[model samples]
Target: MAESNKHLPRLLCLHGGGTSAMIFKIQTRRLQWALRSTFKFVFVDGPFTSGAGPGVLPAFAGCDPYFRWLNPESQTAEQDQRRVRQLLSKVIKDDGGEFVGVLGFSQGARLTAGLLADQEEQNAAEGMPNWKFGVMLCGSFPPLSLSFAKMPSTKPSQGTDEHGETREPDEDEIIHVPSVLVRGTLDPHGEKGRRLVKYFDPETAIAMVFKMGHHLPGAAGDTTSDKGDTQKIVDAILKVYADHLPYEELKAPKTTVMENRNGQLSA
Candidate 1:
């Protein structure tokens, strides 16, 4: 029986390059009810174009300037965050209560980190969410990390690697929290993404590798593996998040209460 306030957490999900929030319709449903309303999934699209279907939104398709994650374009970061915050204002504003965190996939992950950088500002004359935590999926960040630092107002410069080769900027300064990063062993971005955990709260940043590629397997919200799947990925993550909550039981929600039950949620 679903309780009155048995709603899910307000999760701000960012999409990958050339993608939008619609792609998740098929993937996040499994969590809809089982999460006991503790998972308020919010989907946000990137401000760019990609060949993937469901297509990129108009707002992103025409960006004059852009860098697909790993490139610390702070302007891109702020714009994207502002866009997400605006969209979320409808559902999550008025402090709708229980902002579990922002979850980003691929390029979305990079944006997620940027969003945090925006919120942690000491002089937040700007409106950045004082969020709870963040999750990165198959993504990493670059440095000189200021959410709006690279914005057109004060565009950030590209960085260089140790070898004097102009590389992407350092991503270390972008985040400040206990974050969890998920990657697939077979995923190309695995190693580098895992390192981001160190940049965030080392005590809280955790990484998980699946026997998969860039995306998690599923027709829609299902984790399917030809051999087998570690459906435990989501639960395991929620488990580790047990103690770090900053909100009260009524005001702030804890993910632990939302159990995966038999280790798997049903449609």
Candidate 2:
């Protein structure tokens, strides 16, 4: 796709729980073009196998297997933390272009929040620079609570390494990033979902909600919504990128007129 702004920051799109990277394109396509010519979008599937989510697994359209970070164990925050850390590492490394921030939905939104939190931590460790952009939709926090591990087998599986030592991820680690969290008021998980945003420091965290549901909330076909929705989310992300970009040097794309049977702006 044509990039809107050459200097616009790259926004890595992440998918939510019960979803694959495919769900992102539909909502982001217009926003990608509208956000300035250089702005970029890239979507990533999570790191968990879909066997965990039933029918949702095959939705990857027969691509290679995938992975996700979910509540794997009960009575321990380790499982959630470990999985998020792994995910954060992957997103950073997978960032082929400049990673200004991230955008995600449902389970993806949870990850986006996690990534933003992690980024904030990074900035703090590296001496605080403005980090945190991108967007999230529906769902919130760890998609579902990791504190509620449903599987008796949810504990990290013991697998053999070349040396055969138990190769489970380290627990005690925390992944924190600074970013936005959006939720639909009517979503089953929406109210509690706000907790997702509270995990971040108020100075860094920006939370918003809509009267909508589990999906990205917005007016049926408008560019933005008073309630949380993809367009509003993307706009927030762009504002973050533009804040970093040379406003005068990076020009937003000008509207181009399409010719119908006659050369006229379609009304």
TM-score of each: 0.62, 0.57
lDDT of 2 at 179: 48
The sequence of per-residue lDDT tens digits that candidate 1 reaches over residues 151-256 is 4235354653442223333453545565667666666665556555455654455555555666654423225343233344455445545446444543422332
- RMSD after CA superposition, every candidate: 8.2, 12.7
Clashes of each: 22, 25
Choose the strongest candidate by lDDT.
Answer: 1
True-vs-predicted CA distance for residue 60, candidate 2, Å: 10
lDDT, candidate 1, equals 0.52
lDDT of 2: 0.50
- Against the reference, the lDDT scores of all candidates come to 0.52, 0.50
Tell how far residue 71 is off in model 2, in angstroms. Answer: 6.5
TM-score of 2: 0.57
RMSD to native, candidate 2:
12.7
